[model samples]
Target: MKRVLLSAFSLLMCMSASAGVTFNPDKVKAVYIVRFANFIHWPQESSLKQINYCVIGNNQVTNLLESILVQHQVRNIPVVFRQVNNQEELDDCQLVYLTPESCRLGELKIDRLGLVTVSDERAFSESMGMVEFREKSGRIVPVINVDNVAKNNITIRSQLLRISKIISTPQGVEHD
Candidate 1:
């Protein structure tokens, strides 16, 4: 099962590279964002017409994700990327990608529900975010805050949890 997931991820990377776009960390992060939507179960996912991937700021990864979503989806629901500045705009967002600046600006304190917050900002997972992309051995690793996911009534499949660095709470990290 792990191999299957890995292959699917590799295929996504290959697909993006084949599109004449150069492979970069942003591209990998974008791919992970897409895969994350699949691994995590959102409330009323099937009832939604589409999945909204909200970004707190305009950046390369957001652009790459927009392009990637043009060809991919979450459980047949088309994934759309939107630039969101405040909590009001994040209402229908199933997932949100935060920028480093957003983190530094205390945006992490947002007490929103039903949103899987993600970021590449270091220690973000420890700071109440749902997931943080950490660079390890030149690869991007997902550090998931299981507590936060549960807080929002979201569930990350065991398959994904098994492969990720799980944080049982905001102050600690535990391996699956």
Candidate 2:
């Protein structure tokens, strides 16, 4: 397990180093989110036969994720990447990486979807998505909203939550 963690970390570093000025930290962070998926446990009878990582807009994150996934397998399943043009496509993904541009599709009702949605926008409130990634002290970390995750039926591992910077919901509401 340590070896896998080390390998994953090494891959993350290499990706960050290789990312040019055009690459956004959010994109790099999105790649980290993809790595976290490996540690999660989905429902046993999930219709998803493969682990799908979808990017909602044109970004370097998909390329970075592809390169990293090529070297490693998640839960013994091959990781696949897809670029989504619409909400219909998003439904097929296990994790959806949404750019600021894609967030405008609020009418798509993505917040209520079962797939995990990740973004960099601070405007993403508790009702907007499950988790948001932020850059702190030169490192990217996830700010998970457990309530939203539970609403979507996504199971996040305790270990991942321990390291994450959790974002709390409104008063009187508890997160799973």
- Measured by lDDT, the strongest candidate is 1
Model 1 stretches with alpha carbons more than 4 Å out? 1-8, 11-23, 107-109
Residue 161 lDDT in candidate 1? 84
lDDT, model 2, position 111: 60
Q: TM-score for candidate 2, please give it.
A: 0.76
Put down candidate 1 lDDT per residue, 43-81, tens digits, no spaces. Answer: 777688888888998788888878767645666777888
TM-score for candidate 1, please give it: 0.83
Whole-model lDDT values for every prediction: 0.78, 0.67
The sequence of per-residue lDDT tens digits that candidate 2 reaches over residues 82-163 is 7778878876777777776777767666764457777776646355677777677656767788777777777888887876
Candidate 1, after superposition: displacement of residue 16 in Å? 17
